[model samples]
Target: MPAKKNTADKKISKTVKKDIPQLYSPLLKTYFSDLTSANMIYTKIVRSPITKGRIKSLTLEDIPEGYFLFTAADFGEENYVETLDIQTEILASSEIYYKGQPIALLAGPVFTDLLDLEKNIKMEFEKDPASKIKEKEYPYAQRFIRNGKAQKPEEFTKLFSKKNYDIKGTWTSVLNAPSCNEANGAFCTFDKNILTISTPTQWPKHLQENIKRIFNLKTEEVFIRKTISSGPHTNTIWQNTVIAVMASLVAIKTGKTAQLVLSREEHFEYLIKKSPISIKIRSAVKKDGIIEAVQVLIELDSGYHNPFAAEILDRLVIAANNIYSVRNIEIIAKAYESYTPPVSFNIECIDSQAFFAIENQMQKICNVTGFLPDELRMKNFERKFSLPFTFTNEKVREAFSAIEKMYDVNRKFISYRMESKNRKIDIKNLHNFPLRGIGVACGFNGIGYFGSNIFACNQKMEATLESDGTLEIHALQPSASTLEVWKNTAAQILEIDPKQIKLNSIFDINEDLSVPENVYANVSVMTYLLKKCCQDIQSKRFRKPLPITSTKGFTSAQKKVWNKEKFSGSPFFLSSFGAVVLELEINPYTYKIYIKNVKAVLNAGKIGIPKIAENSVKLSIQHALTELVVDENLHCDQISVSFVQSDNDPTQIDGLISRILPAAFTSALSQATGHEINTIPVKPQHFFKEMISNENSVYSK
Candidate 1:
């Protein structure tokens, strides 16, 4: 780690991601398990059992001499952590919003004693039943329109009603259930007003800021040490703070170093999960296959409230009606509080369910218009995006063309359509023939934050070319692999050894190293910054003696100019386009869906490392397939990924496969089962509930 500063002066490097290997064979240290302190006491968080209620009283009994207990009553409301505004409570005060919400922290040298104390604690609650809970709809983040002049969603729908065909649908996207990974833990010692906190988290900078505010310490006083992260994009922003604060408080109160880690169960229960959204779309299309107007109602189960509700809703509208010519589109979305744990709309939140809904709707359109799925997509594909984006029409077109030529998606889709049209099932002879479906969906994910974000980002990144030709980048830690890409970017441009570029990730514990929730955003931003810095240094290398410096900064204001409601941006950065054709055969008897083949084509600018890019797409395919169906996971051998050569810098293409695969998977399912499939994660139960629900079914006919 180099010295601290994320600022890049005048010199940055050109962007290039080289194939790099990780430097590690050493024993990895667990964040908490490896932490050793003679007097450290283990801590556990006791939570609320009821979903919605007021905590009338909480009593702690037999808290022995060395044991400690802390609750919200012991702290001020101002001393809390949040995603942006206030969401998760450090400890519940009066009203409990969800089940398994933390209510108190119990700590002791003997872990078993803490557990015993928790068991002995008596609690009383005044519960509120389901009727009292309000889960209602609210306004959408923005009413976005692409490819045509903007008009009111309602008025456009009314005007188009005369000459248009209407397609309406409602689908639910459930939580992408996560397996528990031990639990979140922290070790803190308060000494000399400098609090040292060790924990595993993606957002260390945010954690430092939170601890500083809570303990009334300065920026440098609250320090964060690099502990092994549980995994990328798994740790919630608030959980780390909550756990750290509890540990820090124990240290302060006990006058000794404190250690607190949630059990596997506690960690799973307390941490925020991805938001589950339900989307309803109503579209009016012309007979010529032109989509005139669309009205969408999205209900998102955001646990309590979504601080990024507007952003999530806005992105949904763009994805649902993007890359096409839709005259007018309106989305009305709401974030409702539920009995479940809190959720997040973080960078990694792909909203596959929403994407699935839109593309599924497109395949359904193909059914009515006598056009194939890709035909309907091409009929509306934009020549050049009217909205401000980085990718070009040529690059987008090449990807589409390659996918069409390579797989002959149209021929296969048509051939499958012809073969599987109106097949009556013979229960006695179900083994004679198999059911297969072909699906295709196009996807484009824009990199970086939207104009209006949940928090005001005022992050500054600095890079200095030391007199010794040492390229030192000052910022928080990104993933090890991504950092290598950044180094290679700088090394290629600076004509310096890649090893000469060192990252000083610990300038302040709270620097946003970027969780790489969307590695494309981080890769693009840092690579661009490094490019500018290196180019500046090259101009001064001969003139100046040594140690040239470059600094770059970003403000929330830089992105605020994007008006998603109107589908416009001052300059939306980079975008990657992808087209996926998934062919699957579903078993009529067992309803098992098996992947026949998945072929994808993408244009993500340039590839510094083709194998890495290809692997990313494959992993995404596996993840999407794992989510789309519960049975017969597809092997990587069955998936083929090819890229379109682009002259521009490498942009993001990591999430393309997962983003659009759900839609295509379901589209294929729709064909195989001879049913109009709208919802994702098609499970075994769906066959019995919907397909076999009627006697006049494809399986029963």
Candidate 2:
């Protein structure tokens, strides 16, 4: 073997720059300008009409000769849309799996020209009239298995039997309404090969990959830049990206940058929405209110293909027990694929169901054996932390305690019940006016991707000591947190002023770096790693402990450090725990619900950037509320189901108020009046209306 390279010989004295003025950086201005311009023009798209049919003939007539057309045929057969390691034809080639699938793309010099041309395109399809697609056949793990033998059907069946449990409770939620009336898109051309495609997106890398694949070029040839838009929390991922890709392709093909915008009708009609779910739980409890076993089955109307059906099911299975210690647990999660658009994950709905099951069961046990819900929960709460199987952090517990104290949960519970008994709050208020009810939910979400899968990051940070003593830091990504890490680590190593250090452009992935483009759940972790590595390098350069920058990778080891899978420890590099309490009033007559106030307590490690952290939490709550109550729909292929109405906002029906309480508050609701809220978007009046009419309840808890 050849001799190993010498570290001492490789070391070089690189001079750093001083006070590099970045305030007027061209890249920054251009980036912002490009984003702004892209948002001005609206882009619209027309999709194929057939589902599960072949494109026998597609004719473009009575349109401009210069118009550009793109289809699955544009990209080579080797290129395909990939997700979760599964590759499928991007544009339907021989057949379409669902309606509204993109088969052909058209673009013109003007937006109207594109729309006019779309009206003229003629197509013929041979539909599988006898086909009846079933949803339950598609298992979440189906894509992960390469061969038919990876997992025997019996294994899944056995696992189901072994882990099964019962759940008993009712959960209700109200979607925080959505604003779909105003929807549009725009694009601009920076250069031939480099175009800054901007739209609402949750997964930037995935969109970038799709663009690269569609263009049939290397990943370096195309770049995707993200801009702040409405959260992609709902179904913006597929809808926005697909439309953007089609528009970008048109611009590239026509040799004139194009902008394809969508109307609100088109946006809702073509996109996917959240699926409504109903879970029935039954449990066996010990005399001490400890759960002996749980049995639960969830019915999810995923609409079309159930893209997130499997993941949702997996989460439900894991969440059945909550933080309480149970001897045996069993869960059955199933999805029903319908003609509607595919439903995405609704976190609030799932949490509500799980909490309702666990909490209601606690209440029932309390009634039978004489105990309080809180008393039982605390009695069975896990005292020790475990890996993948269990989640109970010290900070989470402290956060909960703080919230309880701030909210006076015990006092409220007693006071509310006494008041209700003494003077029954007019039940008519449930229908006629905004009725108020308080609710609290406490839980922690795992930070990284679920399971034992390895999460990889290829990050590098370069620091140069300038002749003027100022340090310039360059990184692969624009990590605001990583800049702090570099500052802290470098300060200790070089004994220099943190303010003197300046951070430069991040490695542009579209230009230089290459790695899988997926959302990094814990971006802070990456920054932390970079900081530690840079600090080590600086220390070694100054003749301190050890050597210069060090590169390290981690994988999920089999050893259980905390009595759980090792992967669980990775997120502990940092953790965030919080609780939310919502107060709502329902109008029984109008079937409306009004949010009165919200109190939340979050413990973020060290609070690196208070503003950003607070904003993130607030945004997360907003997104969750929209998903839980918004009047949205999804189809089979996991696209949004459209409606004839222009306004899709849920707030249109009634009064809605939202307030954010500090992290010092912690508490759950003691009681809620009106119809028993068992499902999300708790429209108690709607339920009462249906019940009074002797109709099946439209809302399921």
Candidate 3:
């Protein structure tokens, strides 16, 4: 059900009805999927069939007059687009990096005609003698921040050697591929060495730069406009560039307009996956249950090549424990390249999996020390282990307390914990027991603007007061839902009617950003930046001339506060805290898990549009639920979300639900099954294997 603005209605409920997407999205038809012209031609790529290899030999047939065939030879050897500083060939010239690497393009007026030509293109490959997977890890990051300065790994080594650690567990997660409804493609036409293309992308400036480097075109020569796309930002960040470049290549060489869109299967197959991570944590705790010394290992499988490996590894280490005081801690995180699809950050950022690993580790602490889940969490939640490492957690205790009282969390957990213990005592006849468990986890998300490409895209905002007293704003067009919110904000700030505000779509400035709508993670930051611009215009409306243009910079305060090198300081743009109480029950006969109820309390700051914010959080929770406990039979009876009423300023909230829900869901399932269930997407086969291997497994591994 779509949320109403009443606080009383925000309670737990059952559901089998799927959430419906907003019916109308402008981006779905911006370039218009119906785009077609008689002068347009379709292109099909000839791909390498092997995972790793070199092109040993090739043969080709003659192309008809209207059809065109091109290869790497058509472009120079130096032609390639580098994503995140890693160079990838536009078309595989000598060696293939992965299976389905494009080797050639065949274009024709008819799409079916091109398919026939691809069959006649003969190709031979020599498989690599060496293995594709390597034991080495690249771009490694290690940090041990303790006592106000960076410490060495040996400090934790000495502590662990003395048998002082009280809690230990290993958690691994696999990122499930997100579902996309619309296919991504581009329409391109290169005339007189100037290329004009319409496509959607997360990083527009990067795409322009890629085109300039490959085609040797000037900055002003390439013109980019938005197109039809509802895909995830993880793919659009780099994937759109590949399609645009291919279509442009065909258009320039054939002297015909070209439209290229990946088929649905191709889009999903080639799309980037979040790096699957395995986190191992060991902690030393006092008799009263305060964590003092800790050691963490993060084994991240960075599929193909990720430019942000260092950032991913660093964020994982920092989020090992949320808002806790760990006096002596050491972190070792290594990223290894693999043969699967490349890994990219999720729409919520890359911290979801890391938060899952640590929160579960915290639950492990609860089981051994006999401290209630919330008791251990709130006791040491606010204390800082070190000044440099302690980022602000806005309402860590408040959110948890709200959900605890709203859902009667303590009483239910005590009951479930007792039931879990009873089942293990009667472990031989587990089928007779009604398996039920509840999990509680608290975490915060603080992704800095620098963490995403919004800043690197050279994002700038402008507002002009027209001579007719109507305000005109030049900015990146936001999503349909947020567009109205932007207008209302500007109108209120200037005391002008919402009808008088005009938003101009920015395209191809050649120096700054023109990102596709909602591609960036932090919508609140974008709105905040726009709010600042409107405020400035409101301040100068009387003193300045009839029309004043504000070309001012809109960089966030985080750039000054964050230190990316040291991996400390206030690296997050703003922090939003959340606590989830998730209940799960298992079917004794089928071995399938279903969500019973979920109660979440969030300190999301002041919500701009309560309905939109509520719907967005619910959708994020649903997506994250698919990541951990996907089942056709799985239906959540209640997923209650309530905002903290204390904060005055608005913080980022839309994507934070996904960043925190997986941890709570996984923790709940682990307790319910009474095994070391530290994996994701809990399949039926996995449950059988887990039970068969460790029928005697307990919480204290």
Over the stretch 336-398, how does candidate 2's per-residue lDDT look in tens digits? 665444555443124444544444445445434544534666666774433235553344455
* lDDT (Cα) of model 3: 0.69
**TM-score to native of every candidate shown:** 0.87, 0.69, 0.88
RMSD of 2: 12.6
lDDT at residue 640 of model 3 (Cα atoms): 78
Candidate RMSDs in order: 8.5, 12.6, 10.9
From the highest TM-score down, the ranking of the candidates is 3, 1, 2
Task: Name the best candidate (by TM-score).
Answer: 3
- The residue-by-residue lDDT of candidate 1 on 1-701, one tens digit each, is 01111111221122222322211111125656568788787878788889888988887655567777777755666546766555556787888877777887777888887777788888888998743235454432334333345554455647456567888877666535454454677888766555677777556555766776766666556566646655343345546766888888777666667888776665555564565577888878788887777777777655555455566665665566556656565666566666667565444444555777788788888877778776677777663334333224355666777888888788878877765664534434445577778998877766655544533233446788997779898765666666877888788888999989998754423344433222322666666666777788888888988888877755446565665445465334567778888888867777767789999988888787788778878887887676665554545458899988877877767667767887887888888777776665566676656656653454454
Local distance difference test values of all predictions, in order: 0.66, 0.46, 0.69
lDDT head-to-head 2 vs 3, winner: 3
